[model samples]
Target: MTITARDIQLKQFKVKFRGFDVQEVDFFLDQLAEGFTNLEIDNRRMAESLKNAKIEIEELKAREEKLKRAYQELKKNLVSLKDEAQSPSNQNTSRMIITEAQRESERILAEARTRVERLNDDIQDLMKQKEMIDDHIRKAIELGKAILKNNDCPTNYSEDNDLKVKHLRQIP
Candidate 1:
């Protein structure tokens, strides 16, 4: 049966010959009750403390898991970085690509320069031919005007007859 301090304090005993004194028994019961009350209070405080400690442990475990995940992620990143730093072929490949691009640009520039030079030579030849043709036409017109001035009457020297006779060839 559950007994409280009040139950211990109010306990009674039967009276008999050669029995224990009431004051001594009552005094002992009071001391025992007081000690039990203090022990119960101490036990309650300890239980509360234990419960709080368990909660703190769970929180610490969760934090530890989070830290572990973060550490693993960081480790993966570090490994990739190390691989990049250790590999020389990737850098060489980039340099090779740049060299190829430079060579391609140089080849295109050379082809364009050659084409421009050929076009300039063709234009010079065309201009020379045009000047020669203009000189021939001017000479032909001047010679015809001189022939008309020297004739006494309007001669019947038609263009078709003159060309058939090659009259221009007869002139200088």
Candidate 2:
């Protein structure tokens, strides 16, 4: 059973001929009741704070799971692209394309890993990191589509080449 401040205030004590002074005992009881009231208020505030913290933690966990799934999907796509590039029929035409794509993907993956490390260090920027990761995935998908569309991967690759991958800068 929970003892409340009002219960303490309403407590009674039988008085004898030489028992303790009534006024002094009542004054002490009042002080004790006030202390208990303050403690209860503080306890309620702390409980609310704990509840909010738990909600934030659950949200962060869900975001982390989403990022993990996206990373796994990206990894699977890269493996498929590598396998396709290695086929005998397309070896000659896809050599340069494969080389360039590998380089670009590696660079993108490294940058992503770096961003993930930063995100781990500071959770407050997770929303921005999610947006950035989505942008990277979109670019990677577009690059793969372009590579598949262009069957003639010429040896004379240059910055002006339509198949050249454009480097994207991070948004502040």
Candidate 3:
């Protein structure tokens, strides 16, 4: 069962003449519940942050794909323009048009290259962020395991959680 702070607070134990101190147990449970609640909040926040980062990455990838397609189209147009410029008819006009087109294509290509480089850098930064978050999560899990071990509780993590960690590590 997923125990909540309220459940911990409301938990009851049978008392005997020689039983452990009730107040001390209650105080410890309260502290544990508070810590658990904080951990839950942090986990939720991290998940949301991860989700946002994934969305941003997807959008950036889509933009990169569009830019690549545009670059290819520009290349094809440049080739066509060059072929037309080679013809004898309207040689002077063709030269001028070819020069203008070349300049424009070069400018566009340069801008596209710059944008792709920037996007690559952004992706690297995001990957670093993801690594840091993953590290934090691993640390949290280790801490939880330690806590459970100290309490003589089972520390075996769920297979689903392991699969998720593996999946995150697999992300490129």
Candidate number with greatest lDDT: 3
True-vs-predicted CA distance for residue 159, candidate 1, Å: 99
Scored against the true structure, residue 100 in model 2 reaches a CA lDDT of: 70
Q: lDDT tens string, model 2, 125-168?
A: 44445455445444443443343232433333222334343311
Full ranking by TM-score: 3, 2, 1
lDDT of each: 0.54, 0.55, 0.60
Write out the backbone clash pairs for model 1. none
Backbone clashes in model 3, listed as residue pairs: none
| Candidate 2 global CA lDDT score | 0.55
TM-score against native, each model? 0.46, 0.48, 0.53
Worst 10 residues of 1 by lDDT: 150-159
Better of 1 and 2 by lDDT: 2
Candidate numbers sorted by lDDT from highest down: 3, 2, 1
Off by over 4 Å in 2: 81-172
Candidate 1 residues lying further than 4 Å off, grouped into runs, are 87-172
Candidate 2 lDDT at 149 equals 31
Query: Could you tell me the lDDT of residue 141 within candidate 1?
Result: 43
**TM-score winner between candidates 1 and 2:** 2
How well is each residue in 1-172 modelled by candidate 3, as lDDT tens digits? 4556577678776776544357755775677567666766766675666567567667766766776677678668767876777768866776787677667766765776676567567656756665675565455444433433323322332224564355435433
